[model samples]
Target: MEKISYSRVWDLDKVFIGGSKSSQFLEHMNRLVALVNILESSIKSLITPLSINEVIKVVPLIENIATIRLYLSQANSFITCLLAENPRDQEAATLRGKVAQEESRFEKELSKVKKIFTYTKEDVWESMLETEKLQEYRFILNEWRENADKNLSEAEINLISDLMVDGYHAWGHFYNNLVSSINVNIQINGKEENLSVGQAINLRSHHNEEVRKEAHYVLESIWKEKEELFSKIINNIAGFRIQVNNKRGIKSILEDPLKKNRMKEKTLNTMWTVISKYKQPFSSYLERKAEMIDGTGMKAYNFWAPAIKSNRVITFEEAATLITEYFSQFGSELEGFVRKAFYEGWIETEDRPNKSAISFCAGFPLTGESRVFMTFNGTLLNMLTLVHELGHAFHNHAMKSVNGLNKRYPLSIAETASTFSEMIIFDAAMKKANSREEKIFILDEKLKRSVMNFMNIHSRFLFEQRFYKERNEGIVSANRLNQLMEESINEAYAGSLEQPSIYSWVWTPHYYITQSPFYNFPYTFGYLFALGIYAKAKEKGKDFEKDYLKLLRDSGSMSVEELVMKHLGEDITSEEFWEKGMELCVKDAEEFIELTSS
Candidate 1:
């Protein structure tokens, strides 16, 4: 293959011609609305304890609704891209509201379908699933049936869905807009410059200690000023969830998250138990890092600082080439897919104001393609993020041939491909390092990521768990929320940091996401799970590639436990499996300490 030219900006024109104003997009949305109306009408005509003939008729409608949802998702993804490029785009924001409205309508219809599935006779439902058109969707169909038992009446669910458009989901949208409009002025090299929240966050990993400190302080202060408003937003979001859970007779907040992840409570308990036992090595790593940086101890901002002084700037071309070349060593199919994604304008990496401080890969099922969004700053961390998102893209590619309903994987397995890709890149960089300083730099970066998955994410999970317990009683005050956050961080980190980020609850977007609750633990789950998968790949060599692809393809169709057993023959609910993953992190920390000590 010839050399491929790269562009930091992605191409959305190929998906839809005119940003948010495209006629094609408007037509697409209009058609989606029409299809949704047809689906609702068809579903409404069906009776409880569905007859075999009625079940046969509804199967086609189910497929139609799935296709409609895919189109709506594509529209949402495009609008999200537009807003990321220009957060102040009122037109794009309006389009987002339109998409949300359609989503609400479709969800109400789905609630009706769920009710029908819940009430149908067992034999009839099983026979229905055995039909030619519905066999591929048996997993999701059964999942919906099981979930329906935990929900309220169909009418009540529809009311909740309708109210949430301006209630629960509106809070999430408000938070996004507020984040985009926030900016701070800071001095850099004797000159002052204004930076958006996203831009300021990138400075947290700057090589200069003073720059990192200033950025942290300013960001914290600004978040402090807005704590009252943020407190209300978070309180209402949690309050809404708690009320709904209480109505459904759900006791613990973790129930919904665990069910959505297809994870058992025992497995979650086992993973945390294993993590708690392995915290010492990470704490020791933190102490070693503080000494290398000549600090009394590690601070919250210093967590991402480079231990050694290196200002190597990796260009977009170099990052792309390096990622693809490293990826090929594992699987040529993945390598080819990533190369196509890069050259085909499937990523948006432009560093600009008003962009969100998050990176993600959004898949479009209608087109069998994915779009990645991030602000690349030429750091090794940024390159790793690029690789991570592409891993999600590859996962999407693996499932493109499957039916849409069976392609809905949970958050636990979603991070597997991305984290695995990051590991490959880290190992490749370590082998290619030419000096002691470079090797330490590579290892330091890898350990930093491990520390985050183990400690920082653990803190978020702990804080949310406590907040929900208190929220069940009444609204939690802003000051009390801060104290809870500090308590959680101190406990999670085992008192390693000089100071905790108390106002983190005000700035972390994961807490405000209405769709996925308890988003914190999934990253930890994916990290360790991918580590286990990577270890297996090493043991099996190149022969594991086909099995790996099969695992990705089946991620959405089974429980995490069953998926692991089928692919790797391991029981995830055991401490031994989680311990194996933690052992990898322990080895990294130990190696880093030994290298730097010499």
Candidate 2:
């Protein structure tokens, strides 16, 4: 174990915190002013030379701008949690908030500088680093620059970016505020207590079925009453996005996200093709889950109920050893990363008062370090979270070499390494199960996730697609949104987890985040991608392991298609890649079903 302490370092660290104080903020402000002056003086040189050397200098300079903003945004993230944790720390919080604005301004200026570069695929290849180590990344760099057709005109792009902060994101903020503060009239354990929607929704995971049911009713009832308002918000936001996409000459709403994600249409199609094809295995797994509950009919509330195999509990320390040992088999580097995250005071995961009861891995974008946040109380799921966050940390470590443009990939790729890491740990544990009970527990959880990751996430993606399409035509009524959601859910989870998931809205943050529309498909994408990669690893054994690290390294560089092709020797645009991956899930489901039946 490592010694843990509180940090009041924001006001003190000039390295990361600039705008929080006059001196610190002035330092960042001065850097911005100086950067602008340098850029202005060389304006003629940039357009005139258009030399490859100029692009090199400019690219790293852009990386520097990104690095500074990344660090500052991460600093603000801590302040955000602090504000949430202690409402009384108003003065410091106010200063911290201002620094966030300064960071945003810095980002805008950096974008302006990047825009000046009339880059081409030839230029990116020409401007790249001369290293045997990274020579392979040249094609990746070239292809990315070649995709600039997707980039909108400078003025329109800037306007859209700015509008996002005040216009689109504001609605999301409103939703968060409304849900967070509103006291819902909920009857809990025979008493009517004013409960927060988030707090009430959490009850759905409780062991007491009645308590979960009541919480669901109260929360759903409240949300139902406000459905009209939420529907309007969704409609307006979707319309705004469509209008922007149309102006950009982007044919589909999905195209913008796909391009923004640096992913190819084929890779996304490959994923859906794979997911939809595997509906049978997923539904079967859900049937097994349904059998565990009483006459509840595998209702939405029951989806979260513990499967027979999920009742095991492990201490945090035990989880650390499990994850570390499992990943160590892959390589020494992964093991060391896990050790640093779990035992070196790098993670803030204790159950504390006034702390939000949610778990997330927040990267300190400046230091290339990440903090794993969760309230740990020694459950099987908690252990899984411990492994999962360490996986995220390892991913940050993986991209450390590509500290420039390749580090920020799409959300689907964002979670690939983490979930892959968890799978590594989970598989290792399942292999070690010594008894029927242990095997069933591990198998049950594993089988259940295969369904949720593929089927449930797939459905959410469908709903978002339909919702966006309908919203583009006109403002969809609240009732329409409900119908869309229900249709997608029922179609995807057909004969799986009850008619209505007590979970559809309660288990997710997607509906509330009007800013990031269609935030659901990434889960399925990452899961299937990882599963596919994992299967390949099994076939090639140690040989595949060598190239696996290479794929993770280049994840920061190329589009999803290029990366998959480079490493996996498979095209991601076709359903074939996904089909192979989905097949592995089916294999696992068969094994689990066989074990349980026997």
Model 1 lDDT per residue over 65-97, tens place:
778878887888888888877888889999998
Which 10-residue span in candidate 2 carries the lowest summed lDDT? 6-15
Which runs of model 2 end up more than 4 angstroms from their true locations?
Answer: 1-45, 48-63, 76-115, 118-158, 182-205, 309-315, 350-354, 499-507, 511-517, 536-547
Top-scoring candidate (TM-score): 1
Backbone clash total, candidate 2 = 8
TM-score of 2: 0.83
Global lDDT scores for all candidate models: 0.88, 0.63
Give the least accurate 10-residue stretch of model 1, judged by summed lDDT: 49-58
Q: How much is 515 displaced in model 2, in angstroms?
A: 6.9
